[model samples]
Target: MKAMTFKAFAVVNEIDLNKIAIHCGIPKKFTWEEPLILKGAILESILGREINAGQMVLIFSFGSVVFINQTEPSETTILLKFIQRFEPDVEINNADRYTDDYKLHIHENESLELADEYVMVPEFEEFYPELISTVLAKSVALEKTEEQLGKIHDRLETMIDRLEKGKLRIGNKELARTTAKILRHEYNTLAYIMILDKPEITWSSSTASEFYDKMMEFFELSDRYKILKSKTEILYNIMDGFSTISHSIRGLFVEWVIVLLILFEIVLTLLQIAGLLP
Candidate 1:
């Protein structure tokens, strides 16, 4: 499961006061419904604690002991206000949690009872994995795209150097073409972001299509290969034309110099014969 952290607020509701009073040393005056901000030392206590994205954080803290069920990490208003005192950098955005994201969990249960898996029912059996895999693939595709782009950039630079040094050559035009075609396959992967806006993505399934769309916004920043291919071609064409023009100009200049020298020799010999020079 993807893991990410976000601010959360929680408040126990309808506490059994008598039970808490007998077992706990703290004052039992506060009912279970009392709102407590989940911030400050408590937040720092659970920092880097992994929780499932979009799940609720079940904090079971009493006395000095904290037990956390980080599987479904969400928060009530109390937890949000509590964490505010610690002054986290980001505010409470009610952000969407895509696959592979986490939320922090804090409680005073003392014992380490980490929830490795999620609390899932039969309803989510199919939709969950498919959606998760889709986003995960997109994330992977994004990383791969960046790496390929770097290689492409290096190739372009090398091609430019070859052009400048009079060694313009395509090492394997067919190979490059094949790779470029594969990169085009990434367009389908990249288009996953737009699948939310388009109906085709959901036509075959259900769920309003929220999670993937959320991460896609961030993914868009890293998505440049689509545009790069077209632009690289244009740049190659430009360099090719420039090289041809330069070669033609160099030939013309050499021809002009030769003609001028020949004319000068003819005139010099004629003048000598005519006694115009000593």
Candidate 2:
């Protein structure tokens, strides 16, 4: 069986594909829906590696790059450094922190089979790399988002603990910051990463569509996205509850201040009536 390995990384918020294309002097071949394909001599020159047959790199605008049949960690490090030129804020460390690996095997007389572990195909098509990269890129992106959500969840739990102890304290500024963080995450995952949207290629080709569906199921992408949405809603409700409590606390404090000022005025009036004040 002829096999190839694929690795994908979600390293940054986004990549400047136009800038990279300008730098490479390669004509812009990528769109928001399609990833830029690098193969043959130019890819070799970029990676500073030998040109192996069937080796390719796919760069996505959503801050993901898939390395097909390129296994070396040093190769990834080198390419990410090059990529950092286009996106100065690109954190190379995330390449390791958020990544997914998949394998493709071509077997004679075998039908296309996709599973969480690997995919087996009768023959590789020109579109296989793009399709596979799409799945891998989103999968790793989801992984990163999942990690982020986990952190938020843990923080909420900490707040809950404080509440249980009757010591919950959060300022309006902190609440605003937290709300913005959650909203940003929701927008990034839904609008930016677009895990729910179908790839454009899949719309034109039924076979590709079928393959993409199978790959999505294999990765459980939709289900995970739903879970993320549900978690977001729960967090929202929690924050809403906190907001209500905060407002109520502030209102009570204001009322107490008003009552104390009234009492002070009454006391002064009583003293004046008794000739205790000039």
Candidate 2 — worst ten consecutive residues by lDDT sum?
A: 27-36
| Top lDDT model | 2
**lDDT for predicted candidate 2 compared with the true structure:** 0.84
Candidate 1 per-residue lDDT over residues 1-278, each given as its tens digit: 23323222212111233433343243445432221222333343344443333432322111111112233333333343333333342133531221233232333433322232222222323333333333333343344444545565566566567668986444445335534644553443244222233223445644525433444444453345356446556545644554565567677879999999999999999999999987
lDDT score for residue 175 of model 1? 34
Report model 2's TM-score to 2 decimal places. 0.92
Give candidate 1's TM-score.
0.33
| C-alpha lDDT score of every prediction, in listed order | 0.39, 0.84
